[model samples]
Target: MESDSHDALDRRLVHALQLAPRAAFSRLAAVLGVSDQTVARRYGRLRGAGAIRVLGLSDPERLGEVRWQLRVRCSPDSAGAVATALARREDTVWVSLNSGGTEIACSTRTPPDRSDHSLLLQHLPRTPSVLGVSAHCVLHTFFGGAQSLAVKSGALSAGQVAELAAAGPRVAEPDGPVPELDAADRRLLAVLAVDGRAPLAELAAACGKSESTVRRRLEELAASGVLYYDLDVDWRIFGLRTHTWLWLNVVPSELAAAGAALAGHPEVAYACATTGPSNLHAVVITRSVRELYAYLTTRVAALPGVQHLETAPTIRIVKGPGPLPLSSPRDI
Candidate 1:
């Protein structure tokens, strides 16, 4: 119960910051119906917890940057070395060891002119596990941060937010047909796109309809796989300060073996099997630098088929989800 209270307060603060990171704490306190000093003191505590991060967003591809995903099959025994190497890479964004921990995945961003293949292929394979790799170039990331939260009250709700997010942008293929959205639904989505988690009553009100009717529409949209409700977490306030992106490369036959071995580590936050030169990508979230070292140096290296490693440290963060179009979460 205590944890929930702290978590709720932190989420409120984070929601406020997502709207404007540099906004005054007094303003935020006023909006939350709290004292200015309370906001300041609470933020200070959150910062100490390592959950609060002041950062900005950058579009690497916009700068003519070269980015790629590496999937690696590593020797389960030496996967830590792979993570170590990844931790050293300046361009690394995130890394993961897939289910069963035999395959490793990573994302990298760098100057378009840089020849990463040469360095990765030649240098990475030499890591202890000894394996091959595959690679993928991400064209763009359509959803991330608060953009993924489409819920807004008044005209929209959590259900609709999920819909707009999953609905995706207009398909641009010569032969592909576009899906149709009714005018009312479209208007609702626009409102939710700005704020998901809105009150159901407010959303119905905005649509000039009954709450039950609006809810039915949301249920239909959700059942269709249009979107999902993923909570926005302000992990920093919880004392989890460390986040690292790692890359690994493993031999083809060793993929499954390596992936399974590394995935069991407690510090790994996200892991996946991706098509790439390395054949795997993952993200590790931890509480401090010491834990990061323990993960990269010992736990990961112990996996099978492990070879090559690199990491990117998070310097700052900028955006996140906010309140729905409604005045409060209870309005629904």
Candidate 2:
């Protein structure tokens, strides 16, 4: 489907989803002013059309696994082959091709404090299919949640979408006020923070709350911009080979502009303004180091106010609730 049209339907669903993922069709219809069956049919169609996908996401860091974003650059013909090799690993979770180059990126769940780059990158360039590779460690996920929906779609009034998207939503800051969580909410989060696929009813039972109440609370939390949700796909089975994180230090004045530039690049999977002397931070996933360094020095660093750059190679993840599944924490 055309991205814009697809995005319109996604926006409508996302707005409603932010309120309640498993909301009754009648309730959804009431909000949307449509027939109950219409709500069901539209959602079914949306799922069938691949315009949206709903799944539980886990934080590799918190799951007693290692996590890193691996960057790869490959020959045009070798892209598929490289991806195939990568998909065969047991650590991979996500993988994709970037625009304009044989750029590919992947995320993997592994052990904490294990910096086995050579082992991870081993044989990466062996097939002549591999061009280059780079890996960056993930440190402190500032905001990891559902992607903000498109504002161009007509589903939401332009003003509404803008207001929602413009709120400058933030994630858990180490020193920032840690929002209070009621006993039930904390209980539910504890369950989700461990197993993303925990059943809703099970979670409710665990928290000594009604199923509906638990569901509503989950929705409220998501709508409040405190979580992100998505499906759990194991990419390692698909042959995605690497995971890495690169740390960088750029001129502060041009930080925003540089960050925007990096975000515009399809190569970047995630970015954030960190709390530190370094100023800005980002997570880039790609097929190879060759592609990664090229992007940082060539494409991203080229932005205005870029002064210095650094990278903390993630040896392995220690622990934390990395990101919520398909539901975004900010959506709440």
The CA root-mean-square deviation of candidate 1, after full C-alpha superposition on the true structure, stands at: 14.6
Tell me the alpha-carbon RMSD of every candidate.
14.6, 10.2
What's the lDDT of the predicted structure labeled candidate 1? 0.52
73-116: candidate 2 lDDT, tens digit per residue: 78877765566556555456445454333766666666555556
Task: Give each model's clash number.
Answer: 83, 68
Candidate 2 worst ten-residue window by lDDT: 232-241
Residues 213-271, candidate 1: write the lDDT tens digits: 87776654433324223333445434455666666676767766666665555556545
| Best of the candidates, TM-score | 2
Report lDDT per candidate: 0.52, 0.52
The parts of candidate 2 lying over 4 Å away from their true place are 3-10, 61-66, 87-90, 99-101, 113-119, 123-128, 140-144, 150-227, 231-249, 252-269, 273-304, 307-332
